[model samples]
Target: MPSRTLSAMDDHDPLTKAISPPPDETAAEKEARVKSELEAKRVSDAIDDDIDKQRIAEKRGPKPVRVLLLGQSESGKSTTLKNFQLMQDAKAFRKERSSWRALIQLNLVRSIHIILDAIARDYYPSSRPLMKDPNSSSTSPSVSPPSHAMPLPKETYLDPELLELRLRLDPLWKVQEQLARRLMIHESQWKEGLHGGREVVVNSAVAWKDVFTKKMANKRESSDSGRINWDDPTDPGRVLHECAEDMKRLWKHPLVQNLLEKQNLRLEEMAGFFLDEIDEITSEYYIPTNDHILKARLKTLGVSEHRVELNAGGGLGRDWRIYDVGGHRSLVTTWVPYFDNVDAIIFLAPISAFDQVLEEAPKVNRLEDSVMLWSSIVSNKLLERTDIILFLNKCDIMKTKLSSGIRLKDYVVSYGNRPNDFDSAASYLKKKFAGIMKEDSPLPRTFYCHLTTVTDTLSTQKVITSIKDMLMRDNLKHSTLLL
Candidate 1:
């Protein structure tokens, strides 16, 4: 047997040297030391008791509904989360308004929406209107039409600087939109370096990052130790100059010049100078994601897309923590740390993307690959006991899949990590996850799954109702705290 390394036990604390071996046993000193030890133990015991009480209370407490949302990038996860937060805040406000506890509390719900709208307006250059009409029955004015019932409405805090930016960009967006439309035209008959042909391309609003965000840059200076500065520019002028130069070169072409004149923005050197100023003004408003706190909040909203926690003990409570990672291949690595603490796992697959799913399956010795590679990654990492829900998301858009009944397995031409049918495709996911967990650990003991989407009320309601029943009813046996 090998001796244990000293580093293994290096975690132990060194003994305190405060006490002198009671000088020749002075009774008074000995008694005082004993009393101090007793007090210290009692204090320690009280803390431990409180913690235990909290844990027990939590176990008996209403099982906060824990949900994990995962999906590919641009899947509208952040939007979903923001909407849900708004709804939740609204309901909470309505509840508090009934009681005259605090004036601030009473306005909590309405304030949540206002703050959210303000934040949105600040971040997005062109904000969708916050309210369609106070009396209108429309759910959300800015969200893409056919809004789904989100858990709550959008609400996130931003730093003062970002808030100021969002305010400044409000009117600029309108100007830019108009410019984009007008610039779709051409220039004059003949000018400086006029060429005879070639057309101009008008692009919509500029990318927010390129125009706005500034990054810190290091430069060599005369001082031995260089100075740090926050005024580092993002090269906005350079970009405008380049674009203007390109536009001028294009205007030199006779075809572009004619089009510009029709558009009314004549091909003049003075116009190019004006464009430079427009770019400068446009560069002032940046997306808030660069700030760590704001970025984290945005990330939180994104995660909440499919996952949420409802704390019965609302204020500053140590409720459940949930993680719902995006399902993109690039985002898969983030899921690893979350996996260890997960009591349950939910995997979302678009039923309409069945062909894509078949091509990306991870099993070996099967034909056809799966386009959604994260499905296999999750399957291979899930614990056997961990409750698993294979949500065939976006079923509203995939009703045809259920009717077609075309098993994915039938499409498998050979054996090279291929799933044979739709049923097999799902099974492959479950089994692959189970096999991986069994090989690694022994904790997860349960697995169940279903299909769902947040696109429609009926469908979303069904999914929510199902989840409520599962996490609150069936699992309530183990969690007496769930309401």
Candidate 2:
């Protein structure tokens, strides 16, 4: 009994000493101190009460459907997210349309700049290499140039008119840099001689849309007519409009086309391609269409979370949260935290990238990387219960490449003797991915696969609807099981 009393006394000593009033306190001082302590305790107790209420509410509420979009860079993850927003929250998606103008403009300018860079390379055949080979080593045998970097034809010659156009369009590079810097892109992210000299990358945490939105707001505030000052000298749109003719000529010139062909530079097949729509895009008051926004190539650097309420179909009123993570090799490590408690993962493997290598890891085949990533994902115990949906994305591009006689067997050597047609190629690759899932998964799970061209709004929306139905059904099943 004495030991129990001493233990209780010891437990209270420090707290009591800390809270006790001074020994020499007056009557009024003691009252004030007591009131102050009471007020603090009241606040602390209220906070605890609110926290407990919140916990209870969370336990009673319907959990939001959580999905993770996983893929390498340029695999259409962002486009898929845009489609979701478009379908579920059309009003909100349209509200951000104006803000996408600057990004689309940047995309157009970057494409123009790439063509210019290709022209420059042809002109300066003996000039120093534009990019260092990431895979090259001093002791190893010489590596061949990447498939995209085909050797310039010996007889290639630039038209003098093309040179004049290049000179006129030189100022647009500054505009590209300006727009890129405004979006928080840094020097390190800018890869010169890579994909037409430089690529624009922004962290998902950066509210890049808000940057342009605020700029437009400020423009409105400054304008007398309450409209954007199109004549603003700093506006990239103005410069793009001014050089629109030259951009068209440069893109259309016969020699320029020949040069691009020799180098295997198919800008149309590339993301953020706008050269074909030069006139409409460079108009004085151009607005991006839904297709343009989806096609715009702004590489995401980190993880981005998007939340929307499902307003239609079986999932009405249910909240959905979609996470888009950076798919670059270096950024893949950041995807681990999001794997926990995720309801589904949409893994995009661009079958069209069979002929290409990763921009970050120059030697790694992109398709192979996708397969490896899939294997790692399925094998992880953390994602054992997570529904894995495989999107053989860029089916359109794959079709085009196959039609152009770019043999899949040439790249995927194990695909030997298979029909080089789109269906055959897509099926083979899909089966290969399915095989990996079956063999490597920690636990058996249903394999959901889709051949998706996420850019096509109608088809993608249909696919998304089906996916929503599936997820909603599964969610209800789990909730019922818990009951």
lDDT of 1 by residue, 1-483 (tens): 998665755854335334545458788888988898999999999999999996897687654444454554323343334333322332422221111111111111111222233334343425452322233233321111100011122454444543443343233222222222222222221011111111122121222112211111122211221222224253232233333333233324454344444433322211011221223222333211111111111111123223234333231222444454543344454654456435455555454443332112333221222223333444444433445555555444345443456444444333235644445455555565445434443444444555554444345445544655576556633443344
lDDT of 1: 0.36
Error in Å for residue 117 of model 1? 32
What TM-score do all the candidates reach, one by one?
0.34, 0.79
**Tens-place lDDT digits, model 2, residues 193-275:** 35555665667888877665666666552312224456666878888889999988888999889989998788887888888
* lDDT by candidate, in order shown: 0.36, 0.75
Q: Which candidate comes out best when scored by lDDT? A: 2
* TM-score computed on alpha carbons, candidate 1: 0.34
Judging by TM-score against the true structure, name the best candidate.
2
